[model samples]
Every structure is written in structure tokens, then in C-alpha cells.
Target: MTHPPTTAIRHSPDLEGELRAASKVTLIGMVLDAVLGIIKVIGGVFFHSQALLVDGIHSFSDVASDLVVLGVMRVSRQKPDQNHPYGHQRIETIGTMVLGSILIAVGAALAWDNILRLIQGGADQVPGWPVLVAAAASVIGKEWIYRYTRRVGQAIRSDLIIANAWHSRTDAFSSVIVLVSTLGAMGGFIWIDTLAAVVIAGIIIHIGWKFTWDAVKELVDTGLSPEDTEMLKAIARDTEGVRNVHELRSRRMGHDILLDIHLVVRPEISVSEGHQIGMQVVSGMRDALDNIRDINFHIDAENDEEHPPTSEQLPSREGIRNLLDEHLGGLPSHTRIRLHYLRNKIHVELFFESPDDAPGLDAEQITRHLQGYPWFGSLRLWFGAR
Candidate 1:
């Protein structure tokens, strides 16, 4: 037996609030990026700091990425529809990938420019005091924004928001590089500023690659970490009626998890009983893991994972009843026949009103008659109410 999907765990009001919070943070970052980008570009030009100029462009890239995050977050929070029954969360993953690619391209271009300049002989002039002030201001502003964004991301469990926060933090780091290199240049080592630009480029590329690769892993349906998978298995095993848990599988859809597992139970239990056991497992998993969105549990009479499924060629209930009728000679009226298909054979139980209803109907006689069949397992007869 299989249970239907569970959806009661998700609350729309809470989700809406989270999305609103994420948007507010992104907008704030966007405004900050734009202001800082303009300042660094102007300061780099007037103060003759190439490193500061490249950092300025990096700040503008953050502004563009902020736009991407805001747009994606809006779409990603939409409820599941007929066209997207799993919701639009993967839109956020795709957006994160795009953001990472943008960082890569920007970092590579800036690095190449600095490398070419270094090869042609470094700048002749030192950056002025104003460049240091601009870089310092950016360091403080970007660090503050990074922390604010990260706090919101963790609260909402949003990967895209967290990725954006790291992007902001990178800007702060690049500004720090600018501050150091500008000071070095002022001390007459003009090559330090250009070298610092190359280092900043490397940092941007590294961060971008990390985000992009993580997104790719999600897109490819990577399972949860080993620790999480084991925890889920432990929860299922602890359920009341589950004899064992096998073939448990899990994957993520945005911040939520989806799971399916095969649960072994006593072979003779009623279908409804097995389904109840599955429900308990689902409840346990949800209580333990808040992010679970859906769970599908297959109730099994035995561990079918290590063996082939009960053979389809075996006689079905109808076929078995016909054989019983033919060999046992018209079983008593209102007879109840129960069939257990296990280990490639059938175990039969027949309940009837009374023994006198079928005179001379001995178990040995029936077994002798049916023993010739390849699929016969065993037989038991009940002459009274079952």
C-alpha cells in the first residue's frame, strides 16, 4: 500500500512573510551597491587607483546580481500550479547559477585587464589620500550589508539569499585589498596596487565557482548529506509497525525535502494497518525535519529489495479460488478464502460455517491433491467463525 502525498506542513502565510523579508534585504543591498559603485569609480579616476576602479566595477556587478535575486525570489515563492506542481523554487537555483556566472565573467575580465597592465609596466603615479577614504567607507558599508543579508537568508532558509550575502561580503574583502594596495602604492611600490587587483579577481572567481557548482549539484538531483539521510532512516526504523526500512531515497526542491521509502511490515497485517504504520513514519519524519515537503512510503510484506517481486505468473486469488472449488468439490456456501503469496508460493486459509458443511474434507486430502502444483505453500482450514 502507498500513502498519498502530505501537504499540511506548509503554511502560506509564513512563506509569504519570508519572501517579503528577502525582497526587502535585496532592495537595500541594491541601493548600497549602486551608491558605492559610483563613488569608487569616481574616486579611482580622480585619485589614480586602478585597483579601486576595478573594485568599483565589482560593486556594480553586485547591483546587477541584486536585481536577479529580487526577480527570482518573487517568482520562486509562487505556489505550485498545474504547470509546476512542485512549485517554482528551482527558479531560484537557476537564478543563483546565473548570478555566479556573472561574477565569473566580471572577475576574469578584471583580472585579465590588470594582468595585461602589469605586463606592460605598472602605473607611474601613487593614489591620493581620498582613494583610501573611499575604500574604507566601502569596506564598512559592504560588511554591514553582508551581515544584514546573511541574517535574513538564514532565517528564511533561502540558498539564493545566502549566496547574494556572500557576494556582498566579497565586495567588502575587495575593498580591504584596495585599501592595503593604495597604501603600498603611496609608499612608492606602485606595482602593489596592480597586483592587488589580480588577487581580488581571484577571490571573485573562487566565490562565483563555489556558488555555481552548488547550484549545479542541486539541479542534478544530488541527495542530502550522509548525516541527514541516516537520520531519516533512524526515524523510520523507530516507527511502531515498521519491521525494517529499505530503499529510502531523498532529494531537495528548493529549501524543502522530498522522500520515498519501502517499509517492511508483518506479512499478515491488513492493508489499512500497513498504511497506518506508514502514516506514523511520515509524522515522525515531519516532526524531526521541518523542511520535509512530501513523503511517499510503500508498505511491503517482506524485504523485496533483496529478492525479485512476487512472480506475476503465480495464480491470482480468482485462479486459486477456482482450483479450490474444482478440487475440494463446491466449498460450503459463504466460505471465506484468504490467500498469502509469499516466497513464490501461496498459503491458503479457508473459513466455513461448520465441519459438517463439507464432509470428509481433510487437510491431508486437500494437500495431497494440490501438492502437484508448483505454487502451493501450505493450507489451514477453520471450521468456525474466523
Candidate 2:
């Protein structure tokens, strides 16, 4: 199970910078898609090229998706509040899902149109050099936007932007189909134009499915890869007082990671020392991974897996103290006692101050006396100097 980090994790400037970069790139893409889409639709109608017209519709869809990206990026940058402790990173994931669904719907409609056209035979008009020119321009424009948007997306770790980049790249490929089919139609093979539209539809559906499938996986809290989990485990294991590390888990929040782990330390240490070890783990992980927003550390005295709980039939502290006094004359009133229950037995530790001249039973005698009790696990006798 996951727990909150020891410290409140805020969205750092790096994430803000990434969002800024993505927004700017997407805005530029929207402008290019609008202009290119208008050009393709007008030219397609004038030259009677159905393939080019469908490609134009695809470009328009990119414009719509870019608008979604711009809107989501704004809300996703909001700070965490009482209502949403994890901030708004999942907004981007949801935006990606919406974008993918839109792409699929648009592609399905285009495919259905083309399929009906193909079944009814081919259009009579031949596409001229004008249609080919528009397709070529679209390929160049959309591909440039694809590369630029993808670079920005990677820099900011924005999945929505990256998905949109692939959407742009799909447009570029679809334009290539439009260009090829336009050339074939000009050569008197008119049916090829409709067939190319069908091909473009298939490509759109494939890319759309990929984006949707990935977003769904993130929504379900899919963990990091095994290799990444091992890397985090290694970081915790290398901490100063951590003897071992286990139960390490991770989940993604935009570009950042939320982690949960258990740090094993020697059982004899104090609570403060265990906390210090946990701090070491937090610092080590923060230094190792820039995008780690939170880590929950659970300190273990020993491997709980190796030593399960036993039946609780042991005597209470007062009962044990009475047994000690009854067996060994008496314990000093100022004595400090600690009890450790382990492996189905009780280990006793007692501390008291004794002057050099004072007389009392030695450590060996105390151990010998406590050994008679079947429930006794071990004994520690400490007499401090006066």
C-alpha cells in the first residue's frame, strides 16, 4: 500500500517550464493545421480529389485536438488543494484520452465515407497538379509541426502533447497517401484515390487506439517497469543504516514518480536513529531522481517475513517485575526496564546505577537465574557507574 511522503511535494519550476514549452508548441501547431486544412479542402474540391479532401478533414481534427491540449495544460498546472492532494497531472492523461477518442471518431467517419465511395465505384474527375501541390505542402507543414511538437513534449514530459505530435505525424503520412493516389488518378487510375483514403483511415485508427490504450493504463495506476523498481530499491539499500530494502513500489504522476518502500535496520537502534535512516533514504532518492515527488518510508527492525507474530500468552511487565523481585531478592527502585518480544519469547533488559563499593549479583548470575523461566528469551543487565 502507498502512503504520503514525509514532506509535502510541490510542483517545481521544471514542471511549469515544461508546461509552458508544450503550450507554445501546441499553439503554433494549431495555427499551421488551420491554414493547411483550409488549403487542402479548397484545393481538393477544385481538383475533384476525395483523398486530399479527407486529408484536409484530418488536419482540422488536429486543430480541435490542439485546442483541447491548450485548455488541459492550464488546469493541469494548478497547485494541489484540499480537494485534490495529488495536484492536476491526471488532467493531462484524461485530456489525452479525450483527444484519442476524437481521433478515432473522426477516422471512423472518414473511413465509412471512403468505404461507401469505393463500393460505388470511382469519381469521374481527374485530380490535376493543383491537388498534388496541396498534398505535398500539407506533408511538409504537418511533418515539421510533428517534429517540433514532439521535441517540446519530451522536454516537458507531457503525454498529451506527445500524443498530439503523433497525431500530426499521422496527418503527414496520410498526406503522402493523398499525394500518391493523386498521381495515380492523374495517370487515369481513378479508383486509387478512394483506396488511398481508406488507407489513411486505417492509419488514423491505429494511432488513435495506441493513445487511448496508454492513457487507460495510466488511469489504472500502472506501476513503473521492474528495472526501474529495482533501481529505486538499490538506492534505498545503499543508505547508511538501511540493512535491506523491500516492498518498493512506484506510480507515475505526469513526469514525476510516487514511491513506497520499507527500510530494514538493526533492531537495537533507537527510534530517532531509524528516523535518521529514513531521512537518508529520502535524500538519496531525491538526489538520484529529479522527478520523484514523494517517498513513503516504513522502517523495520527485522524482516517481519522471517519472524511472524507468536501467541500472546506472556506475562505483563508488572508480573515479570514481581517474578524478578521474588526470585532475586529485589531490584533497585530506580531501575529502568525494557521488554522485547521476539520469536515467541520475552527478552528483558534492565539498567540501574551502582557505586563501585555497592554489592549486587553479577551479569552471569542474573542470566543463570532468568534461564529457569521457560518464557525468557534473553537477558541484558547494565549497571551504570555512580
For candidate 2, the clash count comes to 0
Residue lDDT tens for model 1, 1-386: 12233223332336688889999999999999999999999999998988789889989989988988998999998878999877888998898888788778777886898789778976677789999999999999999999999999989878899889988988897898788778877787756766877888898899889889889988888888999889989988999988898778887777778787888888777777887888888888888888888787887776777777778799987898889889878776588887777778888888878887768988888999889999999998888776
TM-score, every prediction: 0.86, 0.80
Model 1 clash tally?
0
Error of 1 at 191 (Å): 3.1
Off by over 4 Å in 1: 1-14, 325-334, 353-362, 365-372, 383-386
RMSD of each: 3.3, 4.7
Please name the candidate that would achieve the greatest lDDT relative to the true structure.
1
The all-Cα superposition gives candidate 2 an RMSD in Å to the true structure of: 4.7
- Model 1 TM-score on a 0 to 1 scale: 0.86
* Overall local distance difference test of candidate 1: 0.84
